[model samples]
Target chain A: MSQFKYRADTEGMLNTYLDWYKQAEYILSLKPSLPDKFKTSKGAREYHRPQHIIICGLGGSGIAGDLVKDALGNEIKVPIEIVKEYTLPSYAGEETLVIAVSYSGNTEETLSCYVEAVEKNCMIASISSGGYLKKFSEKTGALHIDLMSGYQPRASLPQLLFAILKTLETLKIVSGQPYAEVIQVLRENKTNFSPENEQNKAKELAEKLYRKIPVIYGHSFYKGVAIRLKNEFNENTKIPAKAEVFPELDHNDIVGWEDNELSKNFTAIILRNEEEYMKERIEATIDIMKKYGAEVIELSSRAETVLAKIMDICHLGGLASIYLALLYGRDPALIEPISLLKKRLGEKVGLQKKLLEKLSKTVSQ
Target chain B: MSQFKYRADTEGMLNTYLDWYKQAEYILSLKPSLPDKFKTSKGAREYHRPQHIIICGLGGSGIAGDLVKDALGNEIKVPIEIVKEYTLPSYAGEETLVIAVSYSGNTEETLSCYVEAVEKNCMIASISSGGYLKKFSEKTGALHIDLMSGYQPRASLPQLLFAILKTLETLKIVSGQPYAEVIQVLRENKTNFSPENEQNKAKELAEKLYRKIPVIYGHSFYKGVAIRLKNEFNENTKIPAKAEVFPELDHNDIVGWEDNELSKNFTAIILRNEEEYMKERIEATIDIMKKYGAEVIELSSRAETVLAKIMDICHLGGLASIYLALLYGRDPALIEPISLLKKRLGEKVGLQKKLLEKLSKTVSQ
Candidate 1:
């Protein structure tokens, strides 16, 4: 068996993160109790205008934004573009909305895009804890939300998610208050990371997944959590992981599990939320998965807000996966192959430049 | 490449598909009669009954269904589920709709789930050329579409896409035919795909993409074709490839292009149609990508139904990628790693099955 190397002391990682999460908690706690006046985006003047949104960040910070836009894109009317490079979109004019999200405002891509956004006269908003993004927000007349800064970006996902959702609300795209219940749930979370039966479901779930490739399942809000779980396994444990949402998996992928062989190296963790409609379906999916020969773990959220619940779940998955990573003796931070390719890509220049030029001609014609 | 071999003839690959384009002239050669009116589904009653959809199938057959769902998912009211495994959802019941799609109709997982769908009394349909699925449909009085056979499933994407869209329309989710103008334009293609122009665009495209990754991009209907292109590159070219769609890519991934030395290894192929409203924005994006030195290709349809245009583009990409594979000496048909994994997965008691039993207990509770 390969050794999955985790941090020598869990306390170290946890301590570092606790300080950051506290910052996020502090920001949320300061909101004065005002009468809730919700805005209907469909009725907003901005709805009729041509606006573009440019998101700047990379890796975990970037992927989260990507998934959100991908999952909710059909609903979003204005074009939302994620900028992974230093340059901004050409049409990122005054009407463009620039969202600079960086857990550590020092992120090169976000900072660079920040400069571009400023120059372009785009509407700007920022999410981070005291970094270039924050400084830029202060320098310019931009809305800046300073989140708690200690946890890993993956752990601080809820803070990031809610922050973005709130921004989108300001843009009048969707209602944000409906998510308050999720936030409330996550805030109530207590760190019972025991893995002792019900008290430590994350730990117990990890143990259950010891000899298997983990496939996380969830419906509704937990779908993101499932993805976070997969990334946790990928980044922390360095193990193969996959996540799929409910009712949808029933279609084609379900057939892939008919053979008992798929289970030889597989375990499934099903996240159960209080959703009345999805609850029954998750139950049914669990049965169908088990009938085909697999291990399943059922876990419910115990956080104070939707973001908090997601964070807590992510923390649980991360801790467990980190342990799994340590067990395999793999370095948690080294994603060398991806980095190498990025390097190789930087070197090749001649062919790509021409392609882009030609593509422009085709589009213009 | 570890001495990989191509499945079809080398020379025939490039021009043969282009010749197939000439067969479009054969369309001009035809005695114009009643425009071929293929089946248009009219039954939403059986489908959309459940809050979600589960699609099951494999390879080209499975992926084609996925593309349809991916394209229409955002516009859809209920979630569309796609499962590539051998089981049914535990939650799937009389209210659930299960569509078993198999080009050849003999896939093992599809067969198993086909039986499960019957037992569960789920609304079911079959899209197959011939095999157990067709047989089962006949036996069980299920709606079945016997697609045209003989062509490679990848080549016959048009049939599969049309069938699924027709199914979705019957289900009343998308609820529109606004695609008529776009489809008509692409089918009646007048673009230069011939072996002539100073830049034989298609041939030059085939030659240039010979050694690098093809990162296909698109906005709407071409989204599926982009996926098909990647799969063709992977399954046919045996190369690592990716596909990105707009709106979402703008959120997070766009930022990764910053400082990416590896951007050169990727050639961005933008699949656009006349329907792209944000052409200016995409052009700006293309400029930023080129400035960073990434290859970009912009392609439009031949003016037909989206199915027609999609198939035409896919056919072109398919031929180009296959020839590229031959140049690299990679076998196109061997999915040995996946085959081995399936063998292993079939041998074990899958964890999903165990969860199924536990879920049964929960539902009974």
Candidate 2:
């Protein structure tokens, strides 16, 4: 829409935007392997079967739990609840499995919940590049999955998702290696969205989405993808976007589009898959939104399997968000406000030193 | 901000707007009674203990599940997952409690999920006024809690919430009477927000929220209220609004506010309760939003218990939405577009007759 044009070079002013595209390949190329700490631990084998599972993390790190919940929710025997709060649920006790995920391992909410989980004597695991979570895990002999460093947590989706799936397998809650199939699907499909292709659908969609609020919609399993895309739009494009899961959206949010003024600013991006049971309802909702003057864009998943379809759309959404950031002359990678908040928060509470001391004592034992 | 003024009379042009307020009082006066069908059924007593619970409904009916999940999530022995889709989770089996809620009982999505739950052999229960759901329940001999008719599903929050809580009590998932305290809180606080009260905080907040997008923020237990408030603002005011939970909001959405163009159109309403565990983080999020030029309005909950506080805020939020609707010169009750969609949908699918025929046969048997 603007004067922005597609560039073949990986570095297009913002390295982060380019890195997002490359990360899809990284995710695709990844081998399904668990970290030794998580796989080879006596504690991992000795742990009791939890009646419930609570995954604690926030933002990019936290969203992994959502993906797992949607993707493998029905497959797992126990209930898995995602907690993005500072405190653990009261039921998170000996019978609960607590997975603390933070890319930098310093997320205060995750750390706080981890502490609470430990006090409640819940089985614990940790996933992070490196930070207090790693140190704490080492001290407490908790199963830890060390992710590769130097990427934003949002950019670290592959590692986050892989680790979560691996944890599920290790717990014996789900059988077989599901992550491998997802990787294969990602590998086979990476070329479909390469920037070299002049007709890249993600790029085209991003161009259409320029200068408008993108409302992502999905149903059932795709609900996780909708949320993921909304997060990418916020963090990568720095745009105010929203995600609505269907049937729910059909009820209340569809009416909000009646306001002609606000409707003008939104472009509804509906994620469609043949697997969606309520396709007719989604269509009706799109019709209502379009009739009220909102732009509607439908992106259908091409993958055959449920997991593959989710990954395929997630890759497309990531690329689209990067393209949008480039169009707006934004860095895509820079989140100054979030960094500032984290910094100010650290200064206000200064929990890092206290956590280190606590962990060091545990490590000595 | 507008020429709209508060009036003592319940007839505020829109009967639905007046009805919502009256319904709050009606809820207060409710004796917390479950229908004989739900309480005394041999079928209800014969059901086995479910390892997990899945509540299936959409829109207003679906939100009841969320309220139960938030209020009693910690207390419940098993995990409860709310499904707002046409399909049931794969894990839903004999060991799953499937509570199907649909006010109109003809909601296609709910019916669809009900069918799936039946196929999965999930322990089923139904809550609705009357329609296909009622007929189906009678046919299947499932526990049914029939609600009084003639109100919008969203306006029927009290009945929906109470029936859900009552069902939980009957299942022995929760001990003692939980609804009584909430009803007491609602009765005592109803006068504080009466349309005649010139200094009513909800009305004042609604006035400030006029002609702007409302971004509601709450923490932990208050998250459900934030979502409910957002739904009310959308359906009742016919305006676009957003809800974000604290700690999670701090991680990503607060940065999205930095976009000056998008920030200009939003009024941030932060729901504060004395019991909020992450007060510091919530305050930080508010500061960041305000620093980016978004108008910040804080509404504090006054009730003592968690359930009471949630209900207290929900009641206040309902009044605010109605007030905002009056200000916009929009009728709070008319959902003509939804009705039109439903009519068109029925014509397209010809489902009404088929569902009736199927259920009628079951009812007769």
Candidate 3:
């Protein structure tokens, strides 16, 4: 029953926009309740012997693969490579396991990768709400997990991410239900950041980020979280923000801070969690940011495990982005420009198909 | 005789400031005349077969691995993974080839990766001008390639990229000298963008990007080129520019442009080559950018091969950064902020070492 202040005209335009906050609760509930059907699915068994696993997805759906790559990279027996492009790596073949993830089941890049994997004799699995990917997966007898419909792909991170982890467990590549504890932690920690509480960390962070562009920094361990946060700020807040990994940013971006005019417009957020070797380097980078006149905010992780830390900050980032959108007196769910771009792209595809058909007809005549 | 118009105070401070322009020519001439000793170095012969190649580096040095990963990704038999972290992937082992590249031979991440590789029993090779990496490689009997000293790592793309390719050749992973033709093309095309010529495309482009943040877009084939250009602009021009690959940008960034205030301040440059599948998507994205009131400049590659195209645009981007700096009456070589940051980091490291030594002494007593 709690709502933040916003313009009357903009406030109620998107009725279900606030449901994004429910995703963490939904995901945590699914940890114990994720059907046995999905865990022990035939697709997991079919791809169990793969020498390498290739997860093909794009944008929001694609980022789940990145989270897996960062969180369970060293822990996984086989390499889990995220292919954001249309083509699979050359090493992808009979022994490769390809998971096509498209929340809408219509992402072109994921579809192209799926077709390429099929051509290369790779075992295929799919995760989608319901679209071309699901249809194709079912037709080909590949394992397919249907995500809950009606949510944006970015908002369904928990479901998409769990699907990947559960698949890994089923294949015996990783041991135990690794995400179960993290889910419980998220469920317990959810109420601490409710919008009604002025002490909410996410709202406080969002207040600091208003009217400024964010330059997020993180070490390699949680670089994916930074990336996810950057994406959320861009799509959810409709703000231009960028994320750069540490040590890498030091080599080049430090020079840009010399121009106070540009530096002052940026809010640098440093995300740290159990970073060992690069901890001192990150501290130095923060000192340089502050000295350069840019506002610096450091978010340190207090979670017991790396996965917990990653998920925690990621949850906080999602909340911050949404809160920032509300604070700016803008509707959080209206992505008019993205819809326009996609519509135009669809039209172009339609024209291309028509032209190809006409050319083929002329040839036939 | 070919001097740019700059304020008197900014002029003549660094005589060799424009040597970056001569890099392509230098790189080309070195192709045929490269020392036979370097061509058949002891390191090249020591580890001829690796099940997979892991390139460990950061920033400028790290980007070479990306170039190789993109350029020769499909051609190579084994996977070429770029590690910009302190730890190696779990799959890395005795059969893994770890190429640690630190231009100054002291990049902390590369050194950490080198140490981690040694611990994991992975075959290691070191590339640097000189530092701890060289000394360690020598002591451990690993292959070490001492680079020509006294140049920023960012300006040594030709040498770094070629070293990776030559190593690939030595391992029989790729056939024919792939870089020789690209070098020739670069040398022949260098004069078209001479600083003295007012008709220089680089200078013209730099003028358009003078007061605006550049949002660079490129397909998967040329994403590395876009990244290199972003680095050049950030370091040489001291401007904050962002680079996002096509298909990926279409996913989220299109929404950020809805804010006309922010959109009008950005200049979107699309870097294109022989893109097949995503060409329509990119064109549509450009249309969306234009509709959003942002200036869109399409930079099409004119070179014959992929490598040549990459080098050509990268060359142009470097020139544009320098030209923009000169136009702004600023010194291109003044990296005072980066130097200050490095000094701070060094102090931190020294203090840590002293503390550890003191702690050990106390324990021994």
Candidate 4:
């Protein structure tokens, strides 16, 4: 790890990546029990199985819902809708289970949705570190899982995601996710992704991506992984990156690669899954991209389980994004544009203060 | 229209754009009734209102699901889930209203999903021009809406979209979407987007996006429209374009715009909605992007109704992409890469042939 200058890792993001398995291990070990409120709630006591589940949050925290949906959409008995906005779906009511996730517990969108969830009389559970969401959850007696503070919400994915899975498990909505196996897979694969490994795939992929835009491709099964990688590239590499799923991209995006001159500016990262039903289509798409002069790199997971496969690809992409940032002489930890936007939003609209007040007033009433 | 080179418009795409109102009006005028199958189906007669609705399709055909979800997601009583994959959700059973859309009736993914819908005993309805989906629908007594053929699936959005809206309307799932008013808005605004109109905002936007990668931003409400514009740019303009929703992008994507040198090669198109809850954040985001030296173009719809607003922006974007294609001397109608991919897939896997045969055998059985 010391072989590469760590100047840009202001928050030791690499260390966090290296210890992701540990974070997952610790979170799973905690084995947080379902809140008594959920068990005693009228909706739960009535035992009318939720018609659908709505996971409401945005950005880093909201991604948990996407991951869960991608991993369990086929297996989950009820539909799961992710809300990355300020309001819950109009149909979300007593039969809807709304899980509000916010790392800071202060995300205005999540806070707003929490207020709505309360008003709709939807069965609600929440996960947050400590902020208005945590306060509201405590005040309203909704199920709340407390996360550890001091990490960026994006970096806190393992904690947030596992908490969501655990909550769903507690509700008996899903079971046997192979959390331990996924962590073990990450634990074994970490060394290959480490900077000190001379043949690190992450380093090689980052070299291929340096100074070029990345277009990450995944199939339906790994759609969330594709999005997670794109977000990682955006926040970590500080470069424009795009993600499009297969079959869908085969329909429209393949045409975008026709212009060799413009296509050369992109590096296509195909998150290869051996089990994808449209494997042949993905291969064809890759051939077309390469023929058009875009650099193509294929990344595949060795893990057998869906969760493990998702995390394995995500870990590799996450490291590659950091390496690309280092190659560009950028501080991977810095997100100045986001901060600037937040500052401007605060100064102009006082959105945070207003949302907090609104949540407090609404929940109290 | 004759003033611009028609070499790229071999399929009369521009003419289709001009006559969108007519296409929509004709579809609406048909007043396609619910098929007797749905009227007498166990799920429908029981009046145990569908627990959820699933729209399954891909690419040009599948985007109808997205548009419907975006336009009516809030007002619809049941949660509408758009499945862009080969399989329906495990929970999609008799209580789920499955609307399978495929313009050519031959999209493999849609065929696969239609088969699953049949097996799952889902109350199924389908929209397609003519293909395996139509064949299966006819033989199986599923409600089927026929669209006129020849237009590319992407170009057939108006016909496909209206049919889906009409299906939902006939089912009493959603009502009184200002369809006539939306057509009126498109009819009134089409000329301003026409090539002969020198004051065309679409032309101006195309010029601004001429050589730059387009990054489209929309809030929760117009997320589908943003995706439509991105796809239009990819398919029509033959350039890599990206779309991310607000609040979500503000979390991670904003960090990617910090490098002015790389950022200058990109143009940001903000799909502005005055009714957006986080308007201040979007404005702040634009400020930050401009500060980082990225050119920003804000496109807003003047129509009062949600449906009208959505169509207005989509119409403008559809034209701008074609104009951008003409600027690059590329044929907007020639999706060579997609054709190449399909050819390769056919040679290697014969996906379409297999799906058609499978659907035929399954429906017959």
TM of each candidate vs. truth: 0.51, 0.88, 0.87, 0.94
Task: Give the CA lDDT, 0 to 100, for residue A120 in model 4.
Answer: 75
Query: In model 3, which regions exceed 4 Å deviation?
Result: A1-46, A350-365, B1-48, B350-365
Model 4 regions lying over 4 Å from their true place: A1-4, A38-48, A351-365, B1-4, B38-48, B351-365
Candidate 1 TM-score over all chains jointly: 0.51
Full ranking by TM-score: 4, 2, 3, 1
Pairs with steric clashes in candidate 3: none
In the predicted model 4, the residue pairs found to clash are: none
| DockQ (Cα-based) for each candidate | 0.05, 0.56, 0.57, 0.74
Q: Which stretches of candidate 2 lie over 4 Å from their true place?
A: A5-45, A48-50, A175-197, A275-277, A352-365, B5-45, B178-181, B188-190, B274-277, B350-365
lDDT of 4 by residue, B1-365 (tens): 22245576777788788778877877877766665553222233322358889999888778778887888856887888888888888888888888999998877788888877776778888999897888777756767888888888888788888899988887787776778778888788678887778999878888888778898998766898888998999998888888899889998888878867666777889998755457777878888887887788888888887888888888889888988888887778888888887677657765666765665565555
The interface RMSD values of the models, given in order, are: 12.4, 1.9, 1.7, 1.5
Better of 1 and 4 by TM-score: 4
Tens digits of per-residue lDDT for model 1, A1-365: 44333354353543333333453455455442211221111111122233556777665676557545644534564556666655575556667677888887755546667766655555667788776566565555456777776655655665676677666665565554445554443333334553223565445565666656677876655766776676666555544455665544543234334434323455778777754324444555566667666677877765554545565666667667655545555444444333443344334422233433432332233
What TM-score does prediction 2 earn?
0.88
Give me the overall lDDT of model 4. 0.80
For residue B130, what is the lDDT in candidate 4? 91
Error of 1 at B101 (Å): 1.2
User: What is candidate 2's lDDT per residue for B156-274, written digit by digit as tens?
Assistant: 88778777776666666677646566766666556666667788876887888888888788776788888898899888788877888877877778777778786677788888864
lDDT of 2 by residue, A235-280 (tens): 8778888888877887888888888786677788998864333666
